[model samples]
Target chain A: MDVLKFITCGSVDDGKSTLIGRLLWDSEAVSLDIREAIERQRKHNGQETVELALLTDGLRAEREQGITIDVAYKYFTTKKRKFIIADAPGHIQYTRNMITAASNADVAIVLIDARFGVVEQTVRHTLLASLLNLTQIVVAVNKMDLVGYEEAIFEQIKTKYLVLTNRLKLPKVTFIPMSAKNGDNVVTSSENIIWYKGETLLNYLETIPIIPPQTAESRFQVQYVIRPQGSDYRGYAGRIQSGVYRKGDKILVLPSDLPSEIVKIEENLQEVETAIAGQSVVLHLKDNIDISRGDSIVVQGATVEVGSQLQAYLCWFDEKQALTNGARLLLQNGSNTVKVIVQSIDYQLDISTLEKIEVEKATLNAIVKVRLRTAQPIVFDTYNTNRQTGSFVLVHPNNHHTVAAGMIVLNENE
Target chain B: MKINNKSFDYLDALEAEAIYILREVAGQFERPALLFSGGKDSILLVHLALKAFRPGKFPFPLVHIDTGHNFEEVLAFRDYLANTIGEKLIVRKVEDSIQKHRLQDPKGRFPSRNALQTYTLLDTIEEFEFDACIGGARRDEEKARAKERIFSVRDAFGQWNPKAQRPELWHILNGRLDKGENMRVFPISNWTELDVWNYIRRENIMIPSIYRAHLRECVRLESGQLLAVTPHIRLEPTDEIVQLPVRFRTVGDATCTAAVESSATTLEAIIEEVIQARVSERGMTRLDDKLSETAMEDRKKNGYF
Candidate 1:
């Protein structure tokens, strides 16, 4: 079966953890020992019921503060597919944590309180999800029992959320109203909500089609060269970022722009005639060429931008350091790491208002568009076209911390 | 051209991601070591390492922090595998660390060396100046590990500060480190217990015999958990000793690791048992984690891997 990675984000008290706990409990994913452990904890704390949120709050500080401090991953499997949940924090101060969770997710589950409708947190989460290009958006209207399981309340929240989704230009969205605490319309249909006719949250997740973006052009970056002992055997090893490769196909080495033919492909030490995206393999060319790590290999004549200067949208992650113009950092894309300088800050995105504001410097959790100049030419595609090859990370040279995450943006007139 | 249109298997995707991360560890660090224990998780790491750098020798050596309270079966398997692979194996004994530091042994029936193993691991790191250490830690095993980054950065003292972890975005990993700080990389961070078993069955990888069901003398505790009757344990008068078919779900220090009553002689039966299991791996097999709610988090903060 395939895998589906989704994230849950909402305000501090929207019961994102409770929803996930209920899903695991109902699906038989919670073990008996874990259940008994939680039971003991409940009596110690003198709580009326077992707090499902305790399952996700693994850190001591988080438990003491009664809030999720960082993203916690939870896994469960159904007959149809395996699901990976990225349980992100809801507090506004941990926006960077939410971005880290959303970066690799295929779906974004934005939880909203039925009573409060679409709040600022909901808007911000939806905007961030859209910016990350999540394939689908799931708007779960939680705490419906507090609103008396009224369909009108669900409709009102759905309407408000749709306005934000439309403004953000999100393509696919599904709305579900449920009380996570009561298990209403979550894993199974609820008797109280007979008026609503739709698949439950679990069913929707299992059945949603995951269609990867289609690209015919192949791109591969050589991470390590496997040249065994003192023999004539030499191979280029890396993962295919996109497209496919077949034996005897004409390929070109990037930056050097040398041409060769794919004589052999080896996967897991076995020779294969073809390899596709998401598969790690080694390729042997018909003719020996000068190639090393940080080199890109693609089908001959494939269009890939090779330049030293490029524009990208960056999100600052460092709280102690501020990103300023002309700040030198290392930009790592695929297997290649090049020295880069932040040429200029074009604008900063106001997440709540979706407006571009001019900024001279970016601090923690600030999203901005900037221009960067690399010391050497790098091969890449625009972020919208190919996510694997287009995204990069900026690491501070002095402190050795990842300060920003950037997505390459191609100029229209380039 | 015949295009293989079959959708990618989840196992294949996981393996590919793991291999990619392994290659990154080799490419990024100057001196890296694969932290190998005799457990199935680390065994899987070794298997993946072979697939990652086969024709070319491994870029790093395999290092094991021997707790000295380990099962002989597992230690033998560890040596046999290392010898078969023909790679360098470095073993550091926790016994030596305790003696050198003049640490007091715990006063209990089961004197656990679980916490003491950290000193040896840190000493080994300092001795070799390893810039990176690859482990088999999976996020699904515990909650604290779920929040950890793929390339987790530790301070000079080998402490993990959860709040200060860097943001890991996409497949791009940042292995940048200062002179004293080092990184702990987990290539199989996404694989769950069942995924590991499924991959083992698919690949037909051989594991230690203790993972399979065998007759063993176990002392039944009040909590209905089974502890193997080893020399390290001081048996109580009330403890009931019984010989039953059992197997270890996890391999840890003999003083702390527990066993379960099972008859899974083959990998298929083991996979089925894992699917129908009602307890988490650590919940059923580990005694150290039961001490506190945040036991794993606390240990990780203090340099326990």
Candidate 2:
């Protein structure tokens, strides 16, 4: 089955946990014993009905305080697809945890309480998802039942969210009126709302195309060099982030561009005739050309120049330190780590507004565009085209802390 | 050969990714060993290694930290698997540690040697000078495991500091470690329980028969778990003998392992049973996990694989 990884982001009491619990409960993905445990906990808490949020809240403090504290993963599979849900706490303080969870997610389900409409927290989450380049956003207007299932109320919230989406320029946005508490338009379609003509949330998720990092035109990076012992069988080891290579196919080794033929393909010890994008394999060449880690193997016409300077968007994750010009750190991209110095701080984008805010200091939760100078030539593509080869993380040399995550930008003028 | 078919593509992709990691470990680390137990996860690891070095022998040997209280079926199956696969098997016993006065023996009949397996493991790593030990720990298995990276770094003392892990970026796994330090690589870190079962069914892998349910002599514990009646676990005066249909989802030392009463005799039935199970397998069966909130993390710090 095709795998779909998604993350749920919202503040506490927005029914983020309840929506996830409802999806799991209605889909019959949760086991019988877990359901019983949640039921029992609900009765012990003296609730008239079982609280779905009790299923994902595993910690004692979380259960007692009724708030999510950390990122928890929940798994469930439907007949058509498999889903891994990264449930992150909605508080502002847990932004780091949310980023960690959403870093790998293909879609971001940003839940909003229908009564609250487009609040600041909603904007914060939407901004983060946009900043991370999460293409799909599901603005689940939950708590519709509390609004008496009124279509006008839903429309008002939807319109407000559309205004926010316009500002963020999200690639894909879907608004669904849902009552996560009562299970409306979540897993099961609500009969009360016949005016709405859209697939149920689960149906949409099943059909949504998960955009895996597919870039056919960008340069390919070779991560490691694998040599089978006692044999002349040597190969370039890495996953093909983009493009395709076949046996007897002619290619060029970058930084050198020494042309060679794809003699053999070794995925582990098993040999294949060809490899495509997303297949992590080792490619043996016809010649004994010097191809090492930090070198790129490219089809002759598909090579990009190794650039020493670049502009990129960065997210400052360090709370204790401020990122400014000339901040020295190790910038790692594909198996190559180079000493990078921040050359200039262009501008910082406000988390909620997405507006360029002129600031001398880019503090925590600030997203900024910066120019960087590396000690060595590095090969990369623009993050807009290829996320895998285009992104880099800055690690503090002294403490090995990941201070910032950078997205490579191709257009310097824009 | 046909790009038209995406059938088995995900598995093929995941398998290739895992093999690439295994070969990377072989090339990067000076001394590395594949940590093998009789468990299905580790067996999958062995299979991956075999595929990783086809036409040649595995680059490293297999190490099993024996608690000396393991189920005979598992031990026999372990040896059977090793011989059939043609790999070197190294067994380091906790009993030897006890004999050398390196470990204190618990004086009770139902003593747990689960936590003490760490010393034996750490000593074996030192003895073999294995700088990297590839384990079969899935992040979906437990909460502490959820925080683990694919390439988990361990300190010189075999301590795991979750807060001090290296930032792993897109496919750039850093295996660089200081002297006396080691790494624990989990290839199937993203795989869940259901995924493992599905893969086993798909691959038609061979597993010990104990995984399937059968009649077993057992005693009920305070946690509502059924413990298989064994020689090491002496029956108390009040404890009564009961024969129940049971099987183990996980295999560990018999002293600490618990069984669930089931009638699942096939992988299909087992998968259905797993789908229906309300409590997690680890949360239900493992007594050591229920010991404390940070039990798994604490054990990992003390070098328990």
Candidate 3:
């Protein structure tokens, strides 16, 4: 079965944990012993209802505080597909954890309370997901039973969300109305909303196609070299990330555009005829080239020029330090790491309003645009073209801490 | 097209990635080793490494940290696998660390050498100058492990910092380290228990018979744990000894390892039984984690791999 990875985001009281609990409980993912533990805890706490959120929140501190403190992964599967859910925290203090979880997700499930439609937290999550290049957004308006399952409220909330998501430039957006507490329109169709005509949230998740970024005619980023002992053949090792390559395809090594050929593709002893995106393998060439780590090996049809200047959308994750101009960092892309300096701050973005504010500086949990200069030239396409090669993280050299998360943008337009 | 006559999917992709990582360590790192303990997880790691570099001798040796108090069957199985594979095997005893005064014995009724394995492991690493030590640790096994990266960096003193870690992105893994520092690569970090069983079944790998049920003499301890009646175990008259049909769920130091009563004697039956088990693997097997809330975290910070 294919894998489907998605992230869950919302406010502290938005029932993100409860929604996950409902999904697991209704889908028969929880074992009987786990259920017994939940029951035992419920009795000890003097609560009448069995807390489903207890299933994912593993830490004792989280159980005592009654909130998610970190990104806890929950795995389950349907008949058609398998899933890995990254459940991120909703509190403002834990925004860094949310960013780390959403960075790897193929889809973002942005939950919103039906009673409070399009709140600041809701828009912030959507904006964060969009800024991270997660295009598939599923807006789940939870707590419909509290509002009497009113159709008018659902429609109003969906309309407001569509406008907000459109301004964020998300490629795909789907809206669903559900009550996680009562299990309405989550796993099964609810009889309350007769006017609603769409698949349940579970149905949509299983059917969504995980189409990897098309790297069909683009570039290849060489991560390392694979040399099997007692063999004269050597191959460039890395995943294709975007496009396809054949046995005799002519490729270019970036920063010099030196040409090479695909001699062979070997995993172990068996040789493969062709390789596509998402398959990690080694590529051998007829010539012994001066290829090393951090070098981009690209095909001829689609080539990207080397550049030292980059304009990117960055999410500041560090609360202890503020990002400003002339700040030095270790900019990492693929396997390459080089010193970088922040040249200028373009504009700080308002995630809720989608407005650009001209500011000299901003503190933690702020999203903004900036220009950077790297010590070494890096090659890539825009974030829209390839998600793997177009993203990077800025690490602090002194301690090797990941201070900021960045997404590649069009330098000309910005 | 099928790569190895198996259709390409996410799990298969993950398996290929893990194999690629194993091969990379063999090619790049100068001195490397595999840590084996005759456990199911570590057994699975050895199987993967064998497939990773086939038709040639294993590039690295295998090291086992002997606590001097383990089941005779498990220790025999450990030696059996190494000799059958025709690989060099090394054993570093905790008793040696005690004799050298590197570790002090905890004088108590329930004395365990589990935590002292760190000293023996580090000493062996220094003695052999091994740069990378591959382990079979899954993130879902424990909460602290979930925060671990694929290529986890350890300080010169072998300490792990939860707050300070190199950012890992895409399929790019940076295995570079300065002098005195080393990397602990976990190829099965993304796998779950169910996934491991599925793979084991699919590969038809041979494992120790202790994983299956058998009749054994055992005694019940104070913590409500059943300890096998081995010569290494100290028995008292107060301890109730009984004969039960039981098998080990996890193989570790014989003192801390517990056996669950069962009659599962076949692989297919064991797989079906695991599917219906309510308690997690670690919840019933591991006694070290029950000491505190952040026990694993504290151990990891102090250079316990």
TM-scores (chain A) of the candidates? 0.97, 0.93, 0.95
Which has the greatest DockQ? 1
In the predicted model 2, the residue pairs found to clash are A33-B278, A34-B278
Task: Give Cα-based local distance difference scores for all models.
Answer: 0.90, 0.78, 0.78
**Candidate 3 local lDDT, A176-211, one digit each (tens):** 999887888889998887888988999989998886
**Native-referenced Cα lDDT, model 1:** 0.90
**Backbone clashes, each candidate:** 0, 2, 4
| Model 3, span B89-182: residue lDDT tens | 8999999988886568754444568788878888888899988888888876776776677788888777887655554544546666677888
Docking class of 1: medium
Please say which candidate is ahead in TM-score: 1 or 2: 1
Pairs that collide in candidate 1 are none
TM-score of 2: 0.89
What i-RMS does each candidate reach, in Å? 1.2, 3.6, 3.6
> How far in Å is the alpha carbon of A175 misplaced in model 2?
0.5
Q: What is candidate 1's TM-score against the reference?
A: 0.98
True contacts kept of each: 0.82, 0.25, 0.20
- Per-prediction DockQ comes to 0.79, 0.38, 0.33
